[model samples]
Target chain A: MKGRKINPKRFEIGQLKIILLILPLVIFMGMPIIFIINHAFKPMEELFAFPPTFFVKNATLENFSKLIKFSDSSGIPLSRYLFNSLVVTVITVGLALLLTTMSAFALAKIKFKGRNALTHINQIAIMFVSTAVLIPRYLVICKLGLIDNLLAHILPLVAMPVALFLVKQFVEQVPDSLLEAAYMDGATDLDIYLKVIMPMIRPAVATAAILVFQQVWTNMETSSYFFSDDSMKTLTFYMNTLVNVNNTVAGQGMAAAASLIMFLPNLILFIILQNKVMNTMANSGIK
Target chain B: MAETTKMSRKDKKALKERMKHLKSGKLERRYARMGYIFMIPWFIGAAVFLAYPLGSSFWYALNNIRITPLGRIFSFVGQGNFTQILIQDPDFMIYLVDYLTSTIISTPIIVVFALIIAMMLNMKIKGKGFFRLIFFLPVIIVSGPILGMLTAEGAGSISAIDTQSLTSAISSVLPDIIAKPISDVFNNMITTLWYSGVQILIFLSGLQKIDKSMYEAAKIDGGSAWECFWKITLPNLKSMILLNTIYTIVFISNNSENPIIVLIEESMFSGTKEKGYGYASAMAWLYSVVVLILVGLFALLLATRKDQYEKQVKRAIKARKKEARNKKKIERRNRRNAKKIERQRAAGKITTHTTDRSDY
Candidate 1:
């Protein structure tokens, strides 16, 4: 083992091995997407066919077209729903990132007596299910007069301790010497943080941002409690209506179409930022 | 040492003073102060947002408090909600069984799958980055809203359309061999996309940190490729496996993922004036206990296996040492025999040292 170097001879074999390695990942990754797309496109007859259709075509955009035009008689507007989702998601992501970064910076660089206790408490909070906290959160929301408001969804989500945990882990990797150097150069504590710390921990922040956004956007539990109006519902609530409320052939088709559409933005986001997001997650101790 | 001993007391005292001054530097004190200032946000957030809510929820779970649509609170019944869930609810058992079964099956599969996929992603290959992107995409998009929209009826119907029928008719015009599995495969694919993201990330990171030397050493010792993976790779992944298991159990067991539980609660509480929140909380607590048990069991397995692994490494080291000793003795014997042959040649006598070094 000590005498080994890069083997040019085994390169071909390694490449082949890599192909073999990737095939299942492709299946695992590709299959679900392909299924969802197919489900979205297929007629009911094909969806429940004894032998399923992977490539049944005459694929039309009618389902998607009809889905986009869908508006209930209750005036439960999809656009309003999308807007609410965006608002709540933005608040959740923005607050979560801000709070997490500050706390993480403190935990990593600041020498404090209770630092370890706080860090460990944050870790335990990671395992504390939002479900476990749901009832109390509901009570709190009502008490705060936030019930039925979008803030009800955003505020509790920003409390997510995992974001703090991730940010702190990332900030820990930024050498203390860097902060000292900044201070030596006559930078204030706030300036050092804004200029040096923020730049260094950018990757962690991006990873945390994506994670926070996804969690808030896709969240149903918190939203379900806070928002009752169908018009006030997020896209997920709208999708749920197709499956549980409508439950017809046309409804299922629309549901499938909406599911695909729901995936489109995040899918696009993932595709665009995946390299950075994954690499940052890897660096930020997500693994 | 003499130089240090000969150092002037004045010089030593000055150095000590400098060290003490360094310890209480203004910069250090300010940094410490800044740290507290920075931590205030998270500290405040956690106390108000997390701890307070958690403690309050526990209290709410113990009491029967109802909130009207208009945000009005009804009278509280002490311990009634907990008792109802513990003793009176039928859906409690059903949810428990559903949750437990799903958990038992999904946890292992997700962890193992994540491990395998991570290993694959870690390998050197063409389009490795591309594949990673694909694997992670499912996780990104399969949000509840997105999935809900995809499954929505009028919003995004999944029913068979006239065009689908036409395509099927056209596809039936083709051979059965290609069409059958493709269709079935496509229909079920999207449903499984939601859970693969975390698994892939876990596995990829686990694969990244495995030492390359392990494979090199195994190969040099005439070990097969498969042997290298089993001996070196699997044991190293134990902690990762534990993490993914716990994550999977928690994610799957959560009522949010399985909406059917809520529907059942609705059914059980349909005719009654009760909200069944107490019953649901009780069930949640029980399920959380099961999760804790699962986590504990996995930890135990990891601990025992780690011990076994350490022992095995020790034995391997010992065997290698013994083999090295034997090889050294054989080499020494060969050297002595060669010396004797050289002397015999000098004396013009026949030599018996005919062994080939190549054969040895």
Candidate 2:
């Protein structure tokens, strides 16, 4: 039987057919990414070349140096925005992970009053576009006196409905018998949650972490809306201003460089945690 | 043996019920308390961030609000803001129509593209991870400003495709209203495809979860690949398709690049007295309702339709059950008539006689 069996993973001549079909589409899909990198490296002449070049003939770091020079001339240095973004993203990701996992555990495993209702609310929350909540969210932030406060950035983004939904679905997959076994050993709920549940849902936690990080990292809304002070502004907001302030032929290079800088962290994080993200997606389909 | 097994099963159920009773009040209460303790942060967060804002936003939509250095001033305007947005606002209606048409056209394209890519990736191929990495790259890098910059530099569409000719051809064949969005889709084709990054992964994961033996069985039965896909794969993927569709719609609606969102943001900051917090809230409400309706429409379209085979089987079963019921009814009526005739004959009100062919 073993001798006659076909190996599923072995490469076959037939596989070439699929590769041929997919290769062109993959290249087509990958063009923008390639363009982004190339555009960032293009020298001034190539950047503005008529019949825009897809690939850079002359690669240069002039844009990066010029961007640094421009930011240095401004009142707040580039480091300030970078520092603010890093701090906010780290804090928000940490808090959101804790909130989401805890709430998910309660909603999924615990048979309690209002659990169903809370779950339903989270589901409904997923349907709401952020724009729908923008006005009231601003008003709430104002009433809470979070204007210009770093907490404003952290608060509105912490309770992510989609993250909760994903995490809850994951937590539900933790077997009841395992939890009961822990309970029989006189383990407290916190002990079970921290020891038993957390270990099982590591992929979900990682996924949620990446999600919150990306959101807080790229978010300019919080800075543009809440922060009046230039020093407190995030890198994304700063980048936006950097490009818009110099919206000209010369500014195009700086804009390209800034986009690359902004896009790099998300790309790196995803590359590192891509496996866990795939795992989370496997469980993400609406049942 | 069956009797013994049945008795044991009953006994087991009784024992389970007794255990449940024994563990009822105190233990259940303790778990409930623990659950609430676990949910405390979310409760606070939801109240401050979700419920409170939702309530206040609805209230804000109904009134005219001005933000002054001193404080916020509010005047009751009832449905005036909604009416103004619906009737009086020129840009709102135009942008809304454009948004609706574009979303309706682009969503199916994105989902189908994602599905095709997902299917290809699922096959036994070399460099699967590399392809997946490239495919999923967009989800991470895509942001409002970055997308804006990319599109500005004409990186949003393929350099090879002659969008000008394509758009002209589309416009020549189609009406102005319909052609505009189709042309826009072609012009920004790459960005539209980029929107399907997460969707591709979603489909890939779902496809993986399907039992491979089902495909094997179909193959053994001499089914073609196309037949297997339509009969087996498509039916199994119904829920995932709906999920991806809804996700695509919501993502498109809320995207910062979306004109309606940008319009709302502008109106909220506008210095004009007629526009501010109240007007933006009204617009947000209206936009959200439209998004909800779109989601509902897609959900109804994908979810409510039963599979053709399943529907036929259900109808067959119903017909069979109706035939059985009719047979039972006719037997009962014949039995009642026979009993009536026998009673009458015994009581001397009638006599039973052998019938000829004419009587039949």
Candidate 3:
């Protein structure tokens, strides 16, 4: 070992390098996020101003007020869309997470014949072309008299390939000893899944939940197809109606405001559960 | 406890009977059977919701799908729709070109930027978690129709800004007159909107597995930070980069809500469905093929890079040892020269004149 001491400046330089590195992230990610907030608060006229206002000198609740007071063709309230999105997304994510976790736990942990076959099946399912299934899915929904119902969206998304893949990756991390101990306690598979496995994989569950919710929330294909009435439209269909059909500045502004508003639920969820989701993905690489 | 014990005995009897019915090694088989049971709901859903329609679409693509007052029906045209796309369509070529160009440029940028951000995040820094969360916020925010709304509203202003910045950077070394028009059109057409969401998440997770000690070792051996990045970080990220690139190309090419697709949908809504579905399907299939090829190429590149990397590493190790040996030899020569001077002084053979000669 050479008789050389570490330079204090090197540590400072490292810190400086970090700050420099983060500067771009802050500029790119942080600025747009701030713009969304600023745009939300600004009055209509200011938003349309030639040189965009980064900050609102005069803020108003007019956009939110207009959104609430307005009604679409079906006379269903805007709250209905919000309520519908929440209900559909919650159900989809919930059932998907539950079924995926159970299957993943069983596949990853239990020594069983045909596990490899099932895993291969899951892999093949990942490459499924949804467009090919779109017409049939619609027909099935129609035949079942579930067309225009929220279950049409919820049920289809519940068998998500990505969620299953993610949960399988996560469940791989669970120590065999833990599952063995639970088995030794004479816990049934159902009891083990609900009580033991569920708690241990909370972070992975959160990631899967976030991802599922985001997918269901943004899903325009199945959800749009179901909503024959404008009133029954999800937020995505509602926003699209403003641009393609309505074609008015006021409508577009309202759509923009509405889109911004719809983002809040997911954004807030992400912010709150972000640490858990990221930590899970970082440590487990599944999320 | 005694009363429950009697009930438990009854339950155990039932369990034993059920196990016997399942049979010998069939218990383990039953566990897998149970696993498949869990998978059953999704499997059925996938069949009903995914497989059936996809199979039908293949049939539909080869036929004429008409939504008449009677109902929806498909008239089999054999290879008619495919021929129309390949030979009869006017704008088909332009559509393919546009799709391919965007795929080639946008997918790589998104993947590469995600990689860089991931690497930077991997570095031990304060507020690292906060940075990651913020970066991933775009995933939640950039919904399909919301993105449409943003696109319609801004008319690609963000893209324009990025394009202009890039063009100017390129133009700084170019001739002025030649640069202006080229720059303007690029500023108008080519924009670098941050391709958001899952791509970012994939990159972030990919960064996590790289060990930190590699960087520490490089630093100890007098590698500059940039050199360490080139030697250590970039090579380790190959698999993630490949994975992300594949994800991006596939996602972008297959993206239904892209601007051009939206335009096509708008036209169809305007009551001109003549050959629309067939056309869209053709474009989609082509896009899929291009993406598959691109991903395949990237995978090949990644596989080959490993062997190349090992060779480079071996060469570097040899070079480092050679440098160390050279330094040791120089040190020994300096020690021998010092001894020679000391001997000259001991023999009194070196006077002030002799000392001046040594200095010379």
Highest-scoring model, TM-score: 2
The candidates, ranked best first by lDDT, are: 2, 1, 3
Off by over 4 Å in 2: A1-12, A73-77, A101-111, A129-132, A142-149, A166-209, A248-250, A278-287, B1-38, B140-142, B146-180, B211-224, B227-232, B305-360
Instruction: Give the winner by DockQ.
Output: 2
What's model 1's overall lDDT? 0.64
DockQ of each candidate, alpha-carbon based: 0.24, 0.40, 0.21
Candidate number that wins on DockQ, 1 or 3: 1
Model 2's alpha-carbon lDDT is 0.82
Which segments of candidate 1 are over 4 A away from where they belong?
A: A1-13, A43-52, A72-77, A167-206, A228-232, A278-287, B1-32, B66-109, B140-194, B202-245, B258-275, B293-360
Determine which window of 10 residues in candidate 1 chain B has minimal summed lDDT. Answer: B152-161
Fnat for every candidate: 0.44, 0.55, 0.35
Q: Write the per-residue lDDT of candidate 1 for residues A189-243, one digit (tens) a residue.
A: 7887788777666656765676677787667776677766555667776676666
lDDT of 1 at B75: 48
- Tens-place lDDT per residue, model 2, B271-298, is 7899998889888888888988888898
